[model samples]
Target: MSVLPRTPPRVARRGRAVPVGGVLLFAVGGTAATIAVVWWVAAHTGSAWSPGGDLAVYRDAAQAVRAGGSPYQVDRDGYGFVYPPFAALVLTPLAVVGPLAGYAIWTVLSTLAVPAVVWLLVDHLTPAGDHRRPTLLAVGTLAALPLSPIAGTLLLGNVNIVLLALVLVDLLRVRGPQQGILLGVAAGIKLTPLVFVVHLLLTGRIRAGVTALASFVGTVGVGALVLPADSVTFWAGVLDSSRTRPPGEEAYGGSIRGAVLHLLPEAAHGVWLPVSVLAAAAGLAVAVWASRRHEELTAILACAVTGLLVSPVTWYAHWVWSVPVLALLVARTWRRPAHRRWPAGLLWLVFALPLPWWVGYVLGWAPLTEPAWMMPVDLLYTVTAVALLVLAAVWLRRTAPAARGCPR
Candidate 1:
């Protein structure tokens, strides 16, 4: 089949047997209802958090952009607003609306993205004729909502959820050369998704990889043209938090590299460096093998998990990959004799709880003396992410040769 469709497809898309409007109504309506319900409960219970805290920084950057100034001047979590100029350019509209109104729009879109991701995964990965796509979509979105990654993204008003949706639409929905453009725009805003380009190349989608790279460069070029000073400041490494704060000191960082380094007393880039590199190499190797075996979803997921592990400073927000990752696992294992399905449930429970935050409360995050017991809890997502990668590779290796030709 051609990647580009010249006319309306004779058959409807795999995941969109239902109309898009209906899906949006369900997703957006459900998400908004959940918010209202939660707010009502919180009001009665005297417990609540103001969502869109991070949008304040976004607004600050957007204001700077509107004033023809540099966005890198703003701070986020004690670090600089650590994104490319294109990201600020994208947020410029928020400045026009002001922070409160911006949060309203961003939060609504972010909520829509949360369930849209689930819709995409269910539409693509679930076996046909299952008759449970919508149910699973709703369940998966609800399951993901309380999980730290999605929850933190929603509460903090971050870009991770939207970026997840962008990447998913690019990979699962887009059938043309345009497949890579969304992913490229995502990577332009945050560098982690750039790893998908390498995934495309290793899987023999060389054209897709090249297109993604070109799109990324085009974003940078646009940034340079529109926000020359800010783009130069960013590209010159002016806003790099890693430059001043050693990886070990980033207690909130959930990457394997950061978690391991934090446990040590001194700066150990050498120690953390080789380990994360090796982990990434192994992950990409598994991803390549899965691609060769035609386990395309597994291959795509392996790359996503690998990116979370290897990024210098992954946080709870970056683990937004967990929702689809878990959903894919459940989809592949459901009603199958070849593999057990219970492990996916176990993983869901792990991600659903605030394990690290519980540990933080115990350790009194006062300058954070992460004791031995706290290490595992603090490293919960990182270690599990690494294990999830290894386990996926192992499961792929164990599948019978006869089953190798089918894409799962």
Candidate 2:
């Protein structure tokens, strides 16, 4: 140490070490670029863009709440506002801001929060000495960002990102009473996330499942107690609308069911419901089997993604939620030293290719196209969805047993 501090052995390297500053620059630069692009698209498109219809709906609901009207009571031309009143109450502050400002704030928060939540989940899953792996996981997550439907979701002002973060956070915790409470809260915010209760049951976490159900029921009870007559009216209206809403109006891109129907005009749209049910059942069975044999969070997430895909009403923007699962799969697959690089390469391709298709749709290229051009895009969509599903299945098969034995 007296002789020039002995040239700290760790600093003596044969190759150039990665500069932390450079890494930070890259991350910040990339995020900035992405934000700029989305902002430009949102600003220039203005009211011409229809992809963010959900955002419009949310904004409208917020306005209604601020106007001393029940969001549920306000008839939104057939797409009745069905979200819990608490959601509108929470969004009241955002409503005070104009739509553009509110959307911008929401987009930034969602984009930033999602990755951070994923990192936390990964950290929880990894072993003590494996802390370094979470950074790799985060990088893979970033790489998959382009594929995230979050762009569409953000543009549309969907609350799914927050719902997704809550679900993922709940899943990462060891199955317990508190986990149930988290699950309940997420489900109460958005009912679809309630599917995780079934997942817990399938995974043999009966106590957790019961707890989640109880929490949901408790929340509902509280809502009923506070809102009373309004709660009943909301439930009735939602049920009526959900049962009777016309097709095409509700179907958005990104759902496997919707995508398949959009791709196959010859097929009856009603077929989608049955097909979706079958797909969901099959996916659930597979997920349960995987969980029983391997217990990997990625596998469970893949199942959840599959369920969303098979659901009849899922929109393209909701697909952003799958990006984290896809990223985790890529990271795990890449970790296998002997594995060929093709899988990773293919993953990148799948992640990047569909984005242009979405852009094309937004630009009205697909709708304006002749049958020939439209057919190809539809075919491509079907192929990509199938490919992603197959890849998820393969990953689940590979990671299940290892995850089962993993000390969480």
Candidate 3:
């Protein structure tokens, strides 16, 4: 018999095998480009930034925990390790490996989140035999790699990706007694995801919501056992929101509060609080409306944006929720008519381009020189967040009558 070349093997995803050799190459190339871009930022950012500062903070916290000390005690006011005590307990292994090894592991895990998120989106939104799924997942992964939020999260060693993944999985796939476990654990690591607990309750997912609450308590109990002092300090509000880094023009701190601070003035800063509250309430109401109509992705994303807007601080990395937001918009509108699809394209450019960070970088240009309106451009992501809330409300209102044959 004539010798024959073996066929390339396929990888299994949600029980379906996909021929994804091209995607692997694209992922590798995209990662190399992302690394090069980070080096460029390191060489150019001057004293304005400390590359890997967040990672350093994490390592320091881990070291403190490893030494049988409190991570809270090591805070020196600048760029502190601001996560919950349970996070420090979970990160203890990073101390054992040391900084360099820990950083490498972190990078691999963070990069892997892009594809993992894409896979989850694909598996949930598209049918198993959909011919376009592999391509869409690969393309989405590459497109997400360089979003200001995603790239910044990688640079900062933030837990946003893990939280995003946890939230996505819990809502999209998990449907049993274990459904809420991931979201609860995520909220334990960082409290922002508590908004999802609200999301679950209003959407009639009472069991999952209660289970998630229990899981959160479980994490806190574990933290108390492992690092009682740190847990006590954190629960007592040792890390106040006011002590966080300034929502200034130098970085992509694009919260609704940050926007109000920049656009108005110091005297107007207090307005952001009530503004955040109103925005969050409106966003949550829209989320409830979407969930009632079986618009699962819309409900989750509405809550995501609400959390970001209502947060005390929303750095560029916090916009990591954009990945799934984009994935959802594209999935819903990619093959529709131009009028229906154009919004997806516009939103893609909003994230895919470096516009928000460019707004930050350009402020340093002497010619620009503190023009009154210059700083608000840094609020691109923030503006998009607000726009999403409005869009969800309006769209849901218009579609309510037809969705599930339910009356508006």
Candidate 4:
């Protein structure tokens, strides 16, 4: 008789399975609550409250475009234009609907899209056969509700969410031809997202980078062709306006640059250029490391999120990109035993603590003039960026050996 080989005792499965039903209930409840709160605020605030300053500018530009007037030539109190002609063209339809209605529709759609996008990013990152789907789903919901920047985006009626979605989707599907088109669309809407072009280039995705550049050029070319004479006027006006406007006049309160200036009052107007240059250099360094390390998509996503925060001009709503970063944090932590839970908890706290502050600011409950207590917002942003960089550095250290295997 052949002796049967003794099987090794199965190790106890680590981490608990998430409850799907509970996650669904929390998501639905949280979404409903968020909508209700926003609607109430909008109704109560009425004309006394305006969306973020950027929204006002965009709305005016939309109206200008719709009135058979050129947005490029229309100087709103000498506030120079920054957006391209393509933005005005896109806003034409919204202008027809009126700013309030357009803002309402955008807020609703963006708020709903936040969780779905977070879920997609998380699903893409997590390994298959993990029994942590419920935990991941719950985490996604929390991210969309608490830590994510959707609240501020909705409250401010900002376009950052749409730009963010386009950028995230482009990064997620960087291998596709459509990535170039999407990147172009994002850059056309908001110029800052153009940084991704550099990211694509440094990664040796030369064809994709070229395609992105071509798409951007084609977009501007078409816009110029359509607007023709007005395009030149608009470009000139924007450059002049951006230079002359002071921070207070520009309503820079909610941006990283504004926050920094708020905390360090001495640097007020002069900090933007230096801060922008430093952010660019840091971003380039991170992108180079990511390329050399052959880092995972999650690591790349983290880099992108960190890059945004480091930028001097980033606003609170733009933090919506952090949803994916938080998702990655949760998914990674969930895979390990209970003893490894601190990182996940810290991530959640960092993501959650700022929601109330953002909401308070948007609602006018937390004015920027209230002494230096407001400095925490800037500090929090700085901490978040540093943490993400640390995470990427650690991951790079671990993957360096594996990445060396690729042919030089």
Top candidate when judged by lDDT against the true structure: 3
Error of 2 at 248 (Å): 4.3
lDDT (tens digit, per residue) of candidate 1 on 308-386? 8888778766788988888777765765564476788788887766645533443455344334434455488887888
Clashing pairs in 2: 52-156, 55-156, 149-320, 294-400, 294-404
Off by over 4 Å in 3: 1-19, 32-50, 75-77, 246-252, 338-340, 353-378, 400-408
TM-score for candidate 1: 0.83
Compute the lDDT of residue 276 as modeled in candidate 3.
84
TM-score of each: 0.83, 0.78, 0.84, 0.78
lDDT ranking of the models: 3, 1, 4, 2
Worst 10 residues of 2 by lDDT: 1-10
RMSD of each: 6.5, 6.3, 7.2, 6.4
Global lDDT scores for all candidate models = 0.74, 0.61, 0.74, 0.62
The model with the greater TM-score, 1 or 2, is: 1
Candidate 2: give its CA RMSD in angstroms: 6.3
Candidate with more favorable, higher TM-score: 1 or 4? 1
Q: Give one digit per residue, the lDDT tens place, for model 2 in 1-408.
A: 010012234554543555546554555565566666677667655343343456667777778777767677554445546677656665678778887777778777766655665565556545443424434444644674576356656556677777777777777754546777777877776677777888888778888888889988877776677566656776666544243233444333445655656656567466766777776777777667666665456446656766576655565456655566555555455445655646666655654555675566557564443333434443454455556557667755665355334522
Top model number, TM-score: 3
Candidate 4 has its poorest 10 consecutive residues by lDDT at 1-10
Candidate 1 least-lDDT 10 residues:
1-10
